[model samples]
Target chain A: MSMGRRLPVYLLLDTSGSMSGEPIEAVRQGIKALLSDLMSEPTARETVYLSVITFSSSAQQIVPLTELMSFQEPSLDANGSTAFGDALKVLEQCMDREVVKATSTTQKGDWKPLVFIMTDGQPTDSWESVADHIKQKKLGNVIACAAGPGADENMLKKVTELVVKLNSLQPEALKAFFKWVSDSIKTTSQSVAQVAADTPIGLPKPDPNNMIIVL
Target chain B: MNTEKATLKDGRTIEFVHDQPRSGTMKEVYFTPDRKSVVCFYKDPCAGSDANRLQRLQMILGAYNPTLPQSHGGAAQNDIEADYYRKLFCWPTGIVVQPRFGLVTPAYPSNFFFPTGPVWLKGEEKNGMWFIGPKNRKWFEKNQPSELGSLIQHFSLCLQIARAVARLHNAGLAHSDLSHNNVLIDPSKGMSIIIDIDSLVVEGLFPPDVLGTKGYIAPEVLSTIQLDLKDPKRKNPNARTDQHALAAFFYWYLLGRHPLDGRRIPPGNTAEEQDLLAFGSQAIFCEHPSDSSNRPEEKQYVPCSALGPLLYDLFIRAFVKSLHSPSDRPTALEWVRGFVKTWDLLIPCSNSSCLHKWFVFHNSTDIRCPFCGTRFKGTIPFLKLRAESRPGQWAMDGQLAVYNQLPIFKWHIYSRVFPSPETDRTRQAYCVFHEGKWFLVNEKLTSLTSPGGNRVPPGQAVELKDGAQIRFSQEHNGRIAEVQMIRS
Candidate 1:
């Protein structure tokens, strides 16, 4: 029989001027740790395909959708302004090219994608229309995290119902967020493996002790 | 992170460790201090009716507990009986009423979660029933003697599941959510454990709270879900639906594909609609005998015929005839009988790399291993048994290919010896084809007589020859089988 359907996970990071030093470094290290943890899980390794997208002056597909074993941590030199609109457009394009649609002739298709958007500052460019377009397309379940005090929750809320506000972009707090992401991905991948791809995916409960506020 | 303690009806107090409760969609499972048992606290408070159902289930379990065996009458035998039920099921042992509504059950052995030694290093764990999917076969490929080592092992596993479900059904309980997710399979051990017993439907006392997992739900149940909840025609999961799930489990275990998942059906406008059609009103068996439209892609899967015609017929009855009619579905007992008969017909494949290392004997002029497509290079030995269902009456039950080290169960020897854990160890004998001769090795049985009328005692061997009659036991109802040698 054919291998299990692939679940594409997109990580959209805001590598803007505000996220220069520690924040960008934390994002890089967090993704590396997530990849390592996912690789250790056989189910996740087999079914989860991950991608990395970064937006500063413009959005770029730093890493295309690939298996965890082949995933490489992309270096983010934070600069310019947060082009969130460009990021959404790039995400839509990547999904269009990368996601495999289910068909009648062949039931082979990628599972519904899970998107994680982490931003430390407010969007400098108009992103509402593009975000609305992608949400209407029903491409995936988007969870937007507003990292640090400068990030706007109202803007993030426009894109997805699942939104979290990190108190600060500290290494420990970022680690906790990434850990939650890893746990959620593991749980979702396992759920997909057990039931149909369209079955509601259960997200992991956030750590109450870790100051990552659920908004 | 303080642990809360609750007292059960039996005066036993269980401390629930709330610090790291494993949460699911409906409940959060916490372990006791001793780690011997777990308490599942439902996220939502149980309704009065739900509590009544739990009480009824407890009563039912108490009644089903086996009495101490007279042969070994002691606390030890009682403990053995308790362990027997525990091994057969992850049955709830007690009810918890403290921090939240919950019930307690024995913790699954650690081996149920992960393999030992090198396999753990490879990050392979039991990981629930998904491991048994055809695509996940590669996970166990590295293990010695592959998980799908032979058709006999698959038959044994399926029979074990059937017996467990049959026992539950006989007790008037139905596993509402019977699916791969609720079952755990250890392929290396060829064993399975049914979990989520809390959701069991007790006739007249309780109704099913959940319909079932998607693919395993009966077509009739799915098709009628849109009707009003109070409608009499609205089908709820019950014994009949359990039969459908049981049949699906057997098919998937043996064939590695869902019985209703075929390419012939058109995709619906929505995924939910597709599910409703594919597994419901428009469902069709992928391997329906008369229709090849829904058959699996030849390059990806072997036909269900690999299990032999006896089992294939049962699949047809289950998925073809019973797709729309619940009454037409084969019962668990019927599946058990079919598996036992098909198991007897298997012959070892000559190719070592073949995933299924055995295939059913076709009795054709040219015998080929259906699994690896390899032809037999030597003469094959067949054992034709005469089944005496009654005194002074005998009939040709069947013929079995004598593969090396093929097991001989009690049912094959004695018509009365049924298959169960109690008789499992005592009823085994084996056939060995070695050194250009075939012999029956008496392992546990005491009675074996050769054609010359000399007794072959337990642990002795008797050469099998053409037309040789061998009595398996000296009892009044003992069965004697005739040997038939064929050269092609």
Candidate 2:
């Protein structure tokens, strides 16, 4: 089969000390659920390439851009203070190195990446400069999720216009969040051709009882 | 599992599993306790509030339905006719008003689901995407070859799809969103069934529920998609759009590639903008006769012309002349006719290990299988059919390639008896090969005559010699078959 254009998806997760115990385990199950959901979808498996960036005292790309069929769930542990700035920097570097740009000569490039960020605590690192750069450049369809009351919605709003909030860091809430994320990606990949320029791809509404969209 | 009962609009009660419902963009579906039907409630809170939508559902479940007999308030005439069409579509049965605005539809036939496979694929709905999409095809070829049928079976499934669409069009209806997601096909059994029948466009009764799915949306619809939904200039999903989608689907099934997706990049900065133009305003047939710019860079790609002249002409009209001009596109009935004619031209591949297993006997001196590049050997016979244009003048109608044990139908014996849901499918005659010679045995034909003007009664055989003309029937519009032999 001829290689087709890709839809890159980035998951930036805050593995701060605040995200231990139930929260950490839920995130692990969430990633597992996401992988299985995407792999089972024909369209997503064909077009979506996934990557994971974890941030604690430092940020690292636990999984580089990889096809859905070949994607491996990474082991996640929560420990250090949230390094939100470092995570954003790592996401930027990965997008720069991975996302293919359309050229007049070659085949069509990869679609604009979809970045999902989840955090349960306030950033311990200086993130304003990088967040402003991402906002000004319109880097991608960046959606930041404030996983608990401790996370700052204002800070997330500064990073990306699209923000959602979970009232609690319960395992059930995290599971629902990830399921919704998987559904969004599946829908995006399935109807990628129908979305026009400038219009953000529509995502399935999350369970209102568990999550809320932050305007 | 716990179950909940919901009252239908017709004062009937149906119980559904009260477990986590499987969600679609617009609805959440729950299986009935018996698992024979599904109750799908629209997620939109306003859906139940819209009286117009409820009325449309009533019309869909009653008057316009093709899968039920007229006695059941459906369009089909009788139970037999209804049963025949019932296999072609999964039509909505009733409206659920108590719980919410929803529909009751029969669960898809078991064959539409994967019986067994890798854990993730087991019991998954067999969407046409798995068969037509190149990447999915590769996955099936590697993971489960049994899931993929031969090329001839694919053609049979396409014919079934054409027949299903024709039935809808005949009733002045349009499958608004005719795409992979809305249709399920069982190529291994040469079967196809259209689902989501509730969304059908019923000609002036109600508007289309959706524009269409990506890759299957009509070029005109996609090109004008930027317009407001109610804008007069915006083309919506109608019968003509269904025709375009049907053509695209047929091409994909036969050629294993999309008709419009090629390497050409439209002028746009964002991927969405580029796709909008690529599949819409700037769309080009990848195999355009005069334009090589958009042709796919695939090695060993079998061109659409390999499908034989009838289908080749249809493909040209579909993608070249009518890609944007909706009115000029071939109708669903026309596709059925094309497939019917092409069905007679199929021949089994000589290579035992050929992936396609069969290939169309195209009109060329070099006969070969396109998939395996296997050359056919030995002599083959063709029956050039002719109908009486005048009192005694014979006009060429069509031809059928002969193979051992090929059963001839009424359509082959009588030029006027075209195959359809209501047509007789019993064999009228049959062909056989014995001792290096071919013979045509009369089965049900009462007035069968040999090339030598001798009566060939039922159960008797006539030698099919080169240049021999056999009269299949003496009745009006009966066909005469002239034999032609070719050595490869």
Candidate 3:
């Protein structure tokens, strides 16, 4: 039997000081729920490879790209300043190293990765240059979510055009965000991610009360 | 733990779970009190506001519905016929008009779900993807081998899907979104059921709401996917496209790989662009006779030819000839007929430990199991069935590779009856090897005549020897069977 190409998904979370206590616990729960949900789906489990990169004082790739069956929930903690710029740099490195590209010799390659960035506070580091490079290069379908009021939508907008916002860092809102992420990944696996290379992803509509899409 | 009431357009009331319901792409699903049925409400507020959707649902539950008898304004002729179709489809039963645009559908049969397994797998619906896709199949092949059924069982799964699609096409309807997500299969018992009936495409009236799933989408439809919905060049889902999906499903079920998902990479800088070209405009069959560039990279694979000549011809017609030409594609009825004929050619493998316990007996001279490469070492009997085409001329109709207790049915004895929903399925006779000699005992045939022209009555048998012939029936369109014994 021919094994299929992988659909790599990278989750970048902000473990800044503001995202402590209840907010951090909710993020842990969300990761747990997302893993179980993706594992149960046959197509998602077959092609979806997941990784996690967290940034507090500095960014670190907590989990390497792994299939759903073998993926473990990484231990998360909240402290220090938000190094959003460092996180983006780490994500770029991991994607370049892990994502496979189709060439003349190799017929099969990984799908363009789906990247989700969740942050509740502003970056305390210089991030403008890396953000412009990532956006101009069109690395992947990067969806940046401005979590809570402390997060600036415009600053995150500089990173990717596809942006959504959560009104609060409450556990319920974070859970809903993760649920939506799972649904989006499921839809991509089950359908053509985008009709063309540059079109917006055909994602399922989210709950209006908890989440808002910044068009 | 709250409950709510929903009123249907027909003045019936149903209660459902009131809390945050489980939602799908387009609908929010709620379970009824006893869990016998589910009430699904369309998420878009405009869906129920429009009258067209109401009319479409009415048509689906009424004249076009196969799960209901004609007396109830459905397509089926009688109760028994309707009963048979009920097992094949989870047809919507009612329309919910009060709460929102919704449908009431029966819960899937229990067998469509995994009864017990790992916590992640238990109680989950047996979507066709779980059993057919390469990665998931690998998991089953390693951890739970019982879920992966034998080769014959997979064939029967394809046959049932063909039969179900034939019924829909017979009524001039098409399941626009026919994919693994909408079709559930239980390979253990050789059963399949099609869900999501509300998305059916009705000609000149209701258009399809969805384009279709990724891998199952027809080439023409995907090629024109970027076109505007109202554009004339945009090809929508129809019966022909459904034929493409039906064939793809059959290929996946039998071969354990996709037919068109090959190694040929198209020109595109991004994955999405490459996919659009590879699966749409530049689609190529992996097993194309002349084009070997798109061949699967797997070191070992069971070629489509392993399924035998009858099915191989259909596969070629489906993937190679009509991949881009929708009109030239093999119809669902054609697939049904092909599988019915192929069913007679099936024989159990001699290898006791073979993963595929049954295989098509393609060649008697080179009797071998394609899966395990085991050759048979004994005498085998074959009954070549013929039908009278002229006054005294008998034409070759089909051949049955005989095995112990292989029962013959009405379709075998009578030439007019092709196995369908309304066909009589009673067994007419059976074959058995007694004392090292093959005998086809007469069980229900009233006019079973031996090669010597003597009537072999019920409870009597005729020895199937070399050059022996038997007339299955003396009535109009009766078939004659010529026995050939081959020793390997």
**Candidate closest to the true structure, highest DockQ:** 3
Best candidate (score: lDDT)? 3
Candidate 2: docking tier? medium
Model 1 lDDT, full chain set: 0.74
TM-score of 2: 0.97
Model 3 whole-model lDDT (C-alpha atoms): 0.88
DockQ of 2: 0.52
In model 2, which residue pairs have backbone atoms overlapping below 3 Å? none
Give the higher-lDDT candidate: 1 or 2: 2
Q: Write the per-residue lDDT of candidate 2 for residues B247-279, one digit (tens) a residue.
A: 988987778888888777788886777778878
Of candidates 3 and 1, the better by lDDT: 3
What does candidate 3's lDDT look like per residue over B39-134, in tens digits?
999988988877777888899999999899999899898998899989999999999987777999998899999887888899888998898777
Ranking by lDDT: 3, 2, 1
* DockQ scores of all models, one per candidate: 0.20, 0.52, 0.55
Off-target runs (Cα >4 Å) in candidate 3 are A1-3, A193-195
Candidate 2 structure quality by residue, lDDT tens digits, A145-196: 9998898888899998889999899999999999989998988777633357
